[model samples]
Target chain A: MSSQDYWKANLKLLSVLLFVWFIISFGFGIIFSEFLDQFSLGGFKLGFWFAQQGSIYGFVILIFVYVIAMHFLEKKIGIKEEENE
Target chain B: MSSQLLTYIFVGLSFATYIAIAIWSRASSTNEFYVAGKGVNPIANGMATAADWMSAASFISMAGLISFLGKDGAVYLMGWTGGYVLLALLLAPYLRKFGQYTVPDFIGTRYYSKTARLVAVLCLIFISFTYVAGQMRGVGIVFSRFLEVEIQVGVIIGMIVVFFYAVLGGMKGITYTQVAQYCVMIFAYLVPAIFISILITGNPIPQLGFGDTLVNSSTYLLDKLDQLSIDLGFSAYTENTKSNIDIFCITAALMFGTAGLPHVIVRFFTVPRVSDARKSAGYALVFIAFLYTTAPAVAAFSRVNFIESIQEKSYLDSPDWFKNWENIGLIAWQDKNDDGLINYSAGKPFEGSRPIFSDEFGSQGQREIKNLPTLDNSNEVYIDRDIMVLANPEIAKLPAWLWL
Candidate 1:
């Protein structure tokens, strides 16, 4: 892939991941928290759990996913900063 | 051993270990001083990042803050950790790839203007000083409460130790010592959480135990806490009563703000490769999540125990833990109805949260706090929310030294 293709692929990965981030943190934790709280997980209501606990767990997992995805992308396309001569 | 003695020995030992690490890792070159010679292992850098990012507020006060805020506390949890995601993916690797030592340097070259670099430096200075000032106060609280030293003496002691390592080791020194700090700090944070979780819910893991049913009872811990809160005229524990917008703004600010801290960004440069920088952030969040996940559990457990122990209990007959924290002034009982029993109800017990102390003592031998009570609720007790986590050992009757 050309450097531009590599950049485009990188943006796509980021967009998908950040969208998931927004849904979990903002969508579930805040906007729809009360609606979602109708369900329960273990001792916590679903929304409250996401607010205090689950969103945090989701964030950690998401970062690792980014790391793995990016590592593979780097290998396949090699966007590792090149020196211009 | 006594709690005081344990604090002395453990605190002394940790300081000595930090100083030793600083000496051993002294920067041999300019590169080492700036970013550990840009050769740090990814995992070690990640651990050090966790230690550096958490701050005194995270260590000493976060659990207490979450306990008080209840559902509202998620703003902090999400904001801080989510900020890391932004940092690793969008910011850190790019900064590392540029091979710059600090944010100002990166801005200076990228923007091709010294003015932009100066602006970055100014912002960094402003943010760092305020952050450090709050941190010193937290250090003071731990020293005064745990070690029985004056807050001033404690702060100076803290500064001297920090100065020694920071000056001597540079970034390499700070990095290694910080890794050691991550171990000690997390151990301290987790032990009390585990103890309290098991004591209340019969589960050893605080994360799961937070959602587990209370020991020998069918009700969930969160459900029990919610009921206990309402029965005492306070809001339900699991309810998110704050406006959704308020929560969103705070969480967004924190998430983006996490990537903004220049100090944290510097950690990315410490690693060898751009990929290493990204993986290092993932690792940092794992260590951070260990504490963040447990905080709400600590919050709920401590809230349940706090309300149960103090609500409607007469002042003189109250547990030693209640009086011990009260004596430190983080807790107070104002009997507006002339009743001797404690009732921690909704709303601030005083006009502002601060209590004005008179020289006179109450009938129950509690200090006479003459602050005009707010007439909003029939509540007759003033309990500072910060005491919940620190006093959890005493509340649960767990033997001391668990935290130390």
Candidate 2:
């Protein structure tokens, strides 16, 4: 694949990752906090859990997700820095 | 005659070590100055980043903030540490790949615009200076209490020390020095905590002690803190009084803001490889979590102690500890009803006695409290939240030498 194609795929993956970020933090944390709160998890109030601890856990997950996604993106693009001539 | 002198001698030696390190590690080139030639070890960088990030707030003020905030205080815990996620994943490697000396340099070069660089620099100066002013003030407050110097003199001394290292060695000197500082500060923080935790819970591990039932209390330590908080006209420790929407937006804003902070992102750039940047962040988080997890426990313990000790006392009978803080202008009680005693109600005023009433009173009553000024000279509310942390160790009935 050419550099142009690689950049295109990278951008697509980025958009999906950003959407997931929005869903966990803004969606579950705010919009669906009430829905989530119906189910108690350990010591935390669901909404408060999402707001405090849950969203944080989600963020760490998202980071790893991006890392794995980026690794695949690098492979797909054939432009991994380690392989550069 | 001996111990105090020994303290002075020990503190003086520490200061000398810092100065010597600053002088020795001074950087000549801009690259060396800004990123330490991008060759820092992952572990060293982690320690350095921890100190750089902890600042006076973490060392001196965070536990107090957590004590007062309770469960909502987790925002600081999650938001602050969660930022490392943003740093490690979103910003760190990309910025390192850009291979710049400063954050502004990365921005300026990436977009290929001088104007962008200039704007970035301007914003950097504004943000850094505003935050630095607060840190300097914190240093002054800490110094005044520990060193027994006047606050203004403390500020001057702090500025001189910071300026010598920050200006002379630039980023290189600051980086290595910060690693040393991380050791000093973490030791300072952990020593007191370890002692206090063992003293109170018969358990020295603060993290576990937080979850474990207190020695005398039936509930987990946090539940007791929550119960105590409600009894004292405050919100419960584990409860969320903030609207969910507000919490979500604020947390989101903070997460992004953490990722965007230039200083933190800049730390990642000092590592040799993109992989190193990723790993350094993991290390940084672990180092930071050492304090973050422990802080809430410290806060819970201190709040319980502070209230239990002082809740029933009359204003005239308020402990020597309370009076000491009042002398520093950190705590005050206005005798709203001319009552000799200060109550939890004294801190919170109703409709009329609020700021509007106070504004009117200052203009009308030549008869305000004599020793304490109602406001700082700037006419702002005078309660300094930072004082809560400083007062905690003392309020816990820790020894006088603990301040050192």
Candidate 3:
């Protein structure tokens, strides 16, 4: 419930979110792309999907998840703006 | 069978969809017009933000730039998208919590000085206009090629279309309409990528095609491209040729600039909660990456296709695609070897001042024309690399539907 605790929780979430970001962009884009490309889904190779569409889709989903996660965190940490009755 | 007709149909469809969305979601109040009543769903906001962020530069220009730059071009890839990290961590949440209608409002309020607000406005106007000029140029090119109209007419049409809804919807109108634009732009971008990837690598995804070995060749596609580039006096395609200092500075500037951009920063303000702003920043990057990641693939595939298939071939022997782009002044060459074939070279700008004529006035003012080098340098004129993306689908002989 303390300010310190709220900061800790948000930082944790951000770190995790950034990890996913790295996996999609750097992992699939440059490093592990060749290995991933050996696999195919639909008409797209895995690496190609990650580069062109998948990473982007993952990014959108992550942000929305962060929003929902923040709501719970806000309630726990006492920063929730009062909803209009 | 009808490439020209298909372009008209697709462009017409996109225009219709955008206008319909604008009319249906027309903003009644300044608040609604600017921020969509501050009630947009986060996912929808993400899509709208993506459209707003991508611009004509991303949709139409980046690939062409990358195709030419080869590995040195990663600055754009890393510079443009990496800024979202700064936005999410440093800027978006605070701006959202403060909650303002415009970026200038935030700077004015946060810094707590009216001078700051005025300065912010001036900076915003300058940056926005610079970017808008690029978009207007892009629209003119797209219109001129696809519709067989003059570039001036195309520019006028684009300005009118953008003005109609931009003025009517304000921010709110722009937001909703942007979501539709995002769909059109992404589809226009990806469909061609998918087809080209298949044609070249037998891989449907472009990102993988970069790493995948060429479809029938023993060499990896990237390796093959690097070889082709070296053969033609270009640095290897995948090698980093830029100074690390230049790369570092450009990357940092692009990251900060992306975060600093007034329009992108404004998108976060529309969200209802501080957390939503952070989330939206992340979402916006994801949406943007769709185009960003695919662009390199488009550039690489098209580059290999052009060099291997079109460049240096005789005028009579060149594919129909080359002749078409050449006529539009988008592609050009000279047989430098005098072998009756195009020999590509980077040409220098001529030393004399040639007058440029403007359509707005028969003789508005005399602006010195800089005759930059063309791709083939046969004529001593330069072809701007931006033309590549616009002309690529045509040059690659992809189906007409892919052009839209």
**Top-TM-score candidate index:** 1
Residue B218 local lDDT, model 3: 68
Writing each residue's lDDT as its tens digit, candidate 2 over B125-146 gives 8878877887888899877765
Q: Is candidate 1 or candidate 2 better by TM-score?
A: 1
Off by over 4 Å in 1: A78-85, B149-153
Clashing residue pairs in all predictions, respectively, total: 0, 0, 8
lDDT of 1 by residue, B92-207 (tens): 98998888899999999999999999999999999889888878877766666775665587688777667777899999999999999999988887898898889999999999
Which tens-of-lDDT digit does each residue in B47-66 have in candidate 3? 88889878878877889898
Instruction: TM-score chain B for all models.
Output: 0.96, 0.87, 0.90
Assign candidate 2 its CAPRI class.
acceptable
Better by DockQ, candidate 3 or 1: 1
True contacts kept of each: 0.79, 0.19, 0.19
RMSD of 1: 2.1
Q: Which candidate do you rate higher for lDDT, 1 or 3?
A: 1
TM-score of chain A of each: 0.90, 0.79, 0.88
lDDT of 1: 0.85
